[model samples]
Target: MTSQPTPFVIGIDGPSGSGKSSVSRAVATQLGAGYLDTGAMYRALTWWCCHTEIDLGNAAAITRAAVELPLDIGDDPSAPTVVVDGTDVAEAIRTSEVSSLVSTVATVPEVRVEMQRRQRELIEQIAARHGSCVAEGRDVTTVIAPDAQVRILLTASEEARLRRRSLEVHGATDEAAIDATRDQVVRRDRDDSTVSQFTEAADGVSVVDTSDLDFEGSVAAVMALVDAARRR
Candidate 1:
């Protein structure tokens, strides 16, 4: 007789415009699991940094003050809400300006420590209720959810990723801006390279290149991996 499959955590990591967000959500929907965006937490802090005029270069100051930063993450999978200090910052956290600077604020060791703690706790709680999680971010698979039963690293060619980002935000309606935004993602990749330590090999990890698949297709790929893991 087949034993009951164990509930597990799924990690999806990739560079910007690699469809991590869209595909992760789709996979969560398919699996009926919770979705946590580790990047947005950093983005929220970045938003706070700019709004409060805090210098990003100082790690000590940021650490001491990081605890005071109000971060609210709602449980709704369809619409996860993020608020900082009572202000609804869900939309603000996704802006191009915030996106561009999030990595700067996130690279701080203190900030990563705090954020990583919160992310891990949140994942445990969500998995307890939902039975599993399909968490995605720059470091989810490698660092944040390294113990997750299933881990996947998703990526795509730079050019393809750029096109996807353009289409996601505005499609053909804003080709020039899409190209510009792609350049920003690339710059962010370069800036984040040194700070990122999320791709170190784990005992078992499935890496996929999403350069060819659309959003649904990528999600399907992740789900297939989950099925294989559950059967293991």
Candidate 2:
């Protein structure tokens, strides 16, 4: 009888527009591991709240929604899906409206606790199924999986980050496009910072600055860290 591979977990944290999602996905694919985009959980909850007519400002209501959020997220890096209450919201949750309000839902203490609980469960489930898993979010490294075998804080300079985000959102990196993208990347990070410390690396966390790296380079940098961790 063949034995299953031992499971491991990789946790990643980064600010908005820092390539956390893309890099983590790529790394997970290369390692043949499951991928969990924890940010998508918050965004899914925000979408659910709006869909149910729950006011974003009502903390108690939002907390209740979090507890009751019927979210089903896929762990496959190449083809991840986010479905809520039988509706595939993979794209809906990425809309500008959800982007603008996700922090509001994510900042509630009760919501974080609930989301963290779910995230931890998902990480363990994915790792157990796939032999390894990569989880990325604003607080994955610090709160969700601080003891992950490979913990990374992927970051880039503000200028680089804004340019990258502009290209992703507007398909252009001109000054005007970057300026237009600033609010989504900068303001969102600022709001989320009030609840999570992603801009800086926590103790024992490795940092990978992608200020000048392309997508492949960013993935390589993160993969290198995972390899080094595995070696230890």
* TM-score against truth, every candidate: 0.90, 0.97
Task: Give the TM-score (vs. native) of candidate 2.
Answer: 0.97
Model 1: per-residue Cα lDDT over 41-115, one tens digit each: 888888888888888788777775567778887655678888888999989988878877787787787878888
Off by over 4 Å in 1: 1-7, 173-175, 198-203
Best by TM-score: 2
lDDT of 1 at 48: 88
Candidate 2: worst-modelled 10 consecutive residues by lDDT: 3-12
lDDT of 1 at 27: 82
User: Considering every candidate listed, which one attains the maximal lDDT?
Assistant: 2
Query: Which runs in model 2 stand beyond 4 Å of their true positions?
Result: 1-5
